[model samples]
Target chain A: MKQFSKTLLSIGTALAILGSAAAVQAETIKIALAGPSTGPVAQYGDMQKIGVMAAIDDINKAGGVNGMQLEGVIYDDACDPKQAVAVANKIVNDGITHVVGHLCSSSTEPAADVYEEEGVLMITAASTSPSITEKGHQLIFRTIGLDSLQGSMAADYIANTVKPKTLAIIHDKQQYGEGLAQTVKDGLEAKGISAVMFEGVTPGDKDFSALIAKLKKENVDFVYYGGYHPELGLILRQSAEKSFNAQFMGPEGIVNADLAKIAGDATEGVLATAPKSFDQNPENKARVEAITAKGEDPSGPFVFTAYAAVQVMSDAIKAVGDTDPAKLADYIRKNEFDTSIGKVTYDEKGDLTESTFLVYSLHKDGSKTPAAQ
Target chain B: MSEASLYFLQQLINGLTIGSTYALIAIGYTMVYGIIGMINFAHGEIYMIGSYISFIVIAGLLGMGMVALPVILVIALVIAVFTASTYGWAVERVAYRPLRGSNRLIPLISAIGMSIFLQNYVVLAQGSRDVALAPQISGSWTFGDPQLFEVSLSYMQLLIWVVTVVCMTALTLFISRSRMGRACRACSEDQGMTNLLGIDTNRTIAMTFVIGAALAAVAGLLLGLYYGVVNPFVGFIAGLKAFTAAVLGGIGSIPGAMLGGLILGVTEALTSAYFPSEYKDVVSFGLLILILLFRPSGLLGKPEVEKV
Candidate 1:
């Protein structure tokens, strides 16, 4: 029995040596960043790229993963679910142990299943659906808070701050939009706040009068939409033209610079809830300065999360003392890493321990500034 | 029921104004296809270019802050129409003309290539960020019994509707009455026979493209004013919808295109209201399937007997 155990131990060591010989080789570690590189929501992909690349670059410079330089490969899934799964297959096939992103909720959600099955850890900086981590993929982690948190926070703010008696809710009916809208609506209902009207608008719509007119008659004090900037901008501009005059509110999707352009002054006084704004925090001053010194904007809250994703991955690899996927994922769950946002510890479900949100009001002169907490 | 009535009426007006713009865009598709028997796939990009041209012109004007509302609309319309005509001509000469007599698939492929190239070129020229188009005619008039159900008529909407209708009527007159119109119709009947006759088929084809492009430009300008934002890639989905509009109205027929545009617009508005707005295009394609399955020739289209 002792001789058989000795033979088994030797086979394990041999296999370990062979595995090391194949993928990591004790000299180099590889990670991947995946997102939409083209198509409509490419800006979201751009943010993913910027976050992952910045993090990867910073890590390699700072003595990456136990004396081995961390290398990165980018895969463009164009934010489609089908393409995202294909990217997942490639990531597994290519033997990347760590990943920083799969941008959109649809893309990230499906890929999470694959990542879990393969034991490849994904720490996405921005996929904001509640159902994403609901399947309980321990290998999957997100730096950005889920839509449920943001949505409930938005609803709380609307109920407490705005105190609008008759609220109206609209959504683009996307997973992000519709899901967030429902979360907020439920939160509002829990607070005894009732929306007079609730509906959804299509993206790329040129007209929103029918929806705006509903808000008009109801005399709604606030209109909360869960969608990206495009339809939100149109709703604002057209609502003002039609003189609906109800205050507009939304999730982080409406906080983009494009909102100010599309809706112009009509976007004034409009409120949107997002993750804690990086610009408003004096604590993040040096981080902002650091990013800008490189001639890039780090004022966007998610940018820090991207930087943190790279930090966490590198730290995990270092903790494990190797680049094996299983070991790296185990290290990730067990370790609490410092990030640009704050110290983050993941639950067994791979969600952050604590998350917060902020609200910003759009200004007339093409600016959006944070609202008082 | 009064609340629902008012809502329906308001949706109808909004749909009509939107429909008018679609009608103009559909005319361009129908006109070009009638003459060439090929879908001008780049027609949507032509519209997008028109919007950008008007945006640049209007931005410059707004920077000066001199032009009145009427003057701004006029100049934007004229600039969009004129600039788009050049794009139309260029598209024919560069992308379509050489491959004209080849298999239909070849021209379709070339048209798609041109569409993508122009979209990317615009994106490169102007960043992907949507530029704010603050069209100044935001003036409105509200009407209701107690004024509780207020419906507004913005100057921008009025201008879009006016330009769309005027362009549509002018185009109808041009096709029905003018010499070039006859040449267009003759070419649609038989390109070879018309070529044998005194018509300058190349010039006529170019003109068809120019006129179609011009209409598409007006549509773009109208959308920019209505939506109050312009992006380089905005033409993609709108163009696909307009092509669908052209097909639904009977691709090569003028009045049919107009009807198709109205139907698509109204259907979209109502669908957005009643169904999931994100799936609004589902209705368009669904209607398309139903129409094709039942009629095959479309709502207003005549049966073209198979040659074989």
Candidate 2:
């Protein structure tokens, strides 16, 4: 009996050594895509994951960076700050030195802090709130334009182009919505224009008739809404029904395809400020096709940005020939990369060095066209 | 008219439009509470189901041909009422029936679970994004000149008021005159006594759910028409507001619920009009607290009396 036990112990020791040897031989680089993969905003996460995975797949297939195949992991934060911090710990524990995620600014802000503290590089693809970069985190970067720039650009466009007499500013009373609204308001005020009415809305509210009635009473020539598409769609539809004769303008959160579905004919001529169109880049044709071939829509939120994020990270790793967070961060800050979304470069603050925001209008057939400048 | 009065009048019209919906949904809560002595938390999901049904019926019929607007509304209403009532009946049978004899907390908890289940069920069947309905009802009537804060009332608002008035009258008569409603009242008073008197108490309870569900369907249809958008989570807020209305009106009293709903709605509209719109919900909830403090039995609720 003792001899049988001894034989079993010897076999287990041999298996353990063999497992270690096999693991050591496996040359793979691990990265994580952390975001709200579930919950209400999950579509955004799904978009990022699709773009990141496709980029990773193309990279590894073409011969991985320095011959080390990339392996991706996903952690769902549900856009909650606490959960995002927890995911940061998980990624760190798993020995993943890089992250491409945290779609919402609220989640990105704290998770970026954790990543910075833990010596991990995080490149969020979609969080646009300016404070994300303003925090002075060396290892934290975003591929998207900040809301401050986007919001100010929108104010200039509205004042110079649309040129309405009076405007009403409406926000969904969230940090993102209120921040964008305030920035636009400041820009508008600087341009010697002030909204006749400013209103706040509950995020999940369906009824906006009362608010619509107020807007009608004010007789504003334009309504600048800082919220997501769901409420914007309802507000626009209700406004049209009441014949308010006011044009609607919103930020990128209102660029969802579902806007047309909810607002129907009302979505026509609805204006929004978004990052310059990725589809317009002729160089991105092949990349878009590759994403579409994977049965994922390339036009989704952050699909191109996420692709750029992965491209920049992988290229930086290849350039440095190492995955040290500080080296990669410094390398990214100093270099320019031609990506699916155009040439990308970052300032010392890790914000995009050159970001452009444009105005787009929704067409009747559920497509967006760049509005006349 | 002065701009202030005109604005106040417009806010009043807005309040009544939303109030009518809260009133309709509040009836479900009051009626169910009257008979079973438990909050039908799933009542909101029943409203949501009704809205989805209306959306399907309207979308389906609109897809078929160019039907008259009135015809489409009637057809959608009939179908949504039938379907939503069936759902309400099933909810009671499956989630609440077996637990009828259990502790009161069990049934309340069961209703909450059923609420969550129904929400996720809709999310699965329909995608989570807001489902925008085509503008089936449009146009409005202006009460004053557009130059100075005109008080405009939309056709949808007019319809909501008409429906609420008609439903309230019909429901009052049904409770006062109908045989089933009498059984419901008796069951509310004393279930054991009603059973002793040969009333089918179980059937009455089920019918209560059916009736409340039908009212919720009407509310759902009108809300979709007014908003032109519906999502799976609509029921949670609407249900919460309606429940507050029911409690404010007196939990077991139908008239109280209607009054409570109107009051809640007007308060929300007025507060938003006069104060920061963000405080609208806060003010409404504060009103609830004040009412509870001044009158624990609510404006019309009867104080509980124990007998030896």
Each model's lDDT: 0.81, 0.88
Which pairs of residues clash in candidate 1, taking residues 3 or more apart in a chain or in different chains? none
Q: RMSD for all candidates, in order, please.
A: 8.8, 5.7
Indicate the residue-level lDDT of A193 in model 1. 85
Best by TM-score: 2
Task: Give the per-residue Cα lDDT of candidate 1 at A105.
Answer: 88
Ten-residue region with minimum lDDT total, candidate 2 chain A: A17-26
lDDT (Cα, tens digit) per residue for candidate 2, span A1-373: 9999999999998799558646954697877899888999999999899889888988999999899988777889999988999999988887789999889999999899999999999999999878888878999988888777878888898899989988989999888788889989999999899999878899888777678777777778898999898888888887777677788999989987888888888889989888777856787787788888878888775888888888999999999999999999999999999887778888999998776577999866778888998
Judge candidate 1 at residue A132 and give its lDDT.
85
**lDDT string, candidate 2, B234-282, tens digits:** 9999999999999998899999999999999999999888876889999
Q: Give stretches of model 1 more than 4 Å off.
A: A1-147, A192-198, A282-353, B1-4, B273-280, B291-294, B305-308
TM-score to native of every candidate shown: 0.74, 0.81
Candidate 1: count of backbone clashes, pairs at least 3 residues apart or interchain: 0
